[model samples]
Target chain A: MTASGGPAVRLVTGTVLDADGAPVAGASVHLADGPVPLPDIAALTGPDGRFSFPVGADGVYTVACRTADGRGARAAVAVGPAGAPPVELRPG
Target chain B: MTNGPHTAVSNQPVEITAPAAEQAVFEGPSEGAQGGSPAAFTSDGLEQVAGHTRALSESVPAEAWTAPSAPLPDIGEASFGPPDMLETVHGPDDRVQITDTAAYPWRVNASLLITAADNSQWIGTGWFIGPHTLVTAGHVVHIKHSGVPGRDGWVKSIQVMPGRNGTFLPFGAVTSTNFRSVTGWTADGDENFDYGAIVIPTELGAVTGWFGFGSWPDADLLKTSVNISGYPGDQPPGTQWYDGRGVSSVNPLKVFYDIDTAGGQSGSAVYRIHNGGRYGIAVHAYGGLTTNSGTRITKAVFDNLVLWKA
Candidate 1:
């Protein structure tokens, strides 16, 4: 959340799951926007397969998640002024 | 003159005069396809040749085979900041990218295509240091203990292609009649002494300008910016990638930098521009979590380069 006296920025949370709906730990999640630099936000899913990033503004972003052996998924999310909803990415 | 296989001597001048027909054969586009034949040397023969070469390297003085101690300062950790990702053109921070070698004419011809003996293909970067000589990583041409637990030796055959851009072969590939390396790497697998040379047919270097190699003190290297361009496996097979960064640290025989690299870039030249010319100061090898390393050229290595260039 931003410090200024505006609508508070929310935390973007998500979970990574394998094909069998099992939590996928150690998966890499990368978020990027055209205006933002590459790898603007990168995180590894915790043991519970959950991860989060703080977003201050509203915009479209490309989020990609991949496993150690190069298998994973990607998606485009549109964030509103309020914030974005939780995301669940599953390996194909 | 016959184009048959010729032996190489450590201190003697190597002269190769291929027959006109053989030269024409190498000039063809399909030369790379001429590997598999019953007449080609067997794996056993290749191993014997590698053993002999290893013996020759053993004759060198002991002091020439040294490396920097482990646990290097500030750069010793195996894994650091971001996960080490392998991809084409795009690096972790988008700081590194693929290079169009054609734009850099000097570097275009300086790169090479290395084909090993087992026909197990790999992209090894090399640069010409003389009219008939090329410098590359020793492990590219020969890897001990490469296969089954006990079976290990030199590769049967090796071919070099200069200025190879994807399917475009500006300069055709040529097989090396002679290959040389230091005993420290071939015999002991010392990464810090992983340097080797190839003696190609004469006149090739004249067409493609070569880079001068020298050893500068670690102090001066710390103050200079280094650039490395090579064929990384992550990119389209033969394409070259470029990474430039300041020195992170240096030990007696190795140079460590923050430059990005991948598998096939092992033999790339780690060089700096000086006096309006590019000079290679190390043979790039070893990719780590935070930094990459190379064998720092020393006086003994420089002398060996001169000898190989002969």
Candidate 2:
């Protein structure tokens, strides 16, 4: 994978929303059965329920999320050098 | 410290072998265990290949060959928190998570779900050193200067899960209260002394295998390729990640590197791979924007590991 400033790397950012289409707060988002990464403790969504992961190469990666109340969702996407669009996760 | 670039990979296993007598292993930290002689520092850490037990049962078909089905009790030490939990990002985060953790090497690293003395939960990494002993960062086991009243001693408990990929725990999890650290770390809270060990009641390591650690000369170490793999909090919960890079710097007490790492990766092994052997050169702890470092394996630290693993 590319380093922090390596031109080959790009960010894949998105948000976690509920069935109501409102941004969910305090959601735990992570790679779907993949390598571990940053964020000192847990990979948590921000106040806006947004989460992000780094895409180093051209491939498909799955991003999954869950809330304390048991709502969960996941998205599998293909990324390229130009980077992919943001993903939306909605757990029933 | 932050890493610029790294040849990051998943938890892919290479050959694991005994130290093939690298004369370098018997070098450096030229001091005796108790102020005796440089000979004291020349000892090699205990390493085992997977499928073999470090301590076997007396009967043929020893229990060591099989895992203990009975659950382990949760034993923990004093308070724990992030007064100094450093996970620096130098650039874009390029960590690769490992889901194929049912194999060698990767299985040695553990996901440390820590229950601090204050009852707050935290996460960190640790690795097997012996059949029943796991090595980790001192702060992971004991909190210091956390600024919380009555929350700076032995943590309450730690659930050690080896080869944990998300929720797929191939080697089932075990909780423990028993731990070991030096006075320098526990009393002084010194960064240089930030290393410790966890002793589980079972010999789970015999199944996962363990790394051999040693203290080599400062000159012999520069630019050596090193590997670091552990559970980072930023990735999926309980997922293991990995990266390999060259040693960036070294002091009498630490070995610095450009390997990409983050928080919760604290206590991961900074190991050197040689002729099929993995030797822990340091116990990873502090992180910087440009370079992350670990408590170097020296005479004092090696002696502690010797005693703790026994």
Query: What's the lDDT for all of these models?
Result: 0.54, 0.62
> lDDT by residue for model 2 over B1-310, one digit each (tens)?
1111111111114312222232333221111111211111101222222222222221336345432221111110111111222235444454556656766667888998887776655667898877788889877777765534554677778899988998799889999888777656666565667788888888888777777888778877773767788887555667788766557677777777656675578889898765456778898875543467788888657756765666
- Residue-wise lDDT of candidate 1 within B2-47, one digit each (tens)? 2111111221245432223211100001112112211111222211
True contacts kept of 2: 0.10
Question: What are the iRMS values of all candidates?
Answer: 17.3, 12.8
- Where model 1 places Cα greater than 4 Å from the true spot, the runs are A1-92, B1-117, B147-151
Give me the candidate number with maximum DockQ. 2
Model 2 spans with C-alpha error above 4 angstroms: A1-92, B1-87
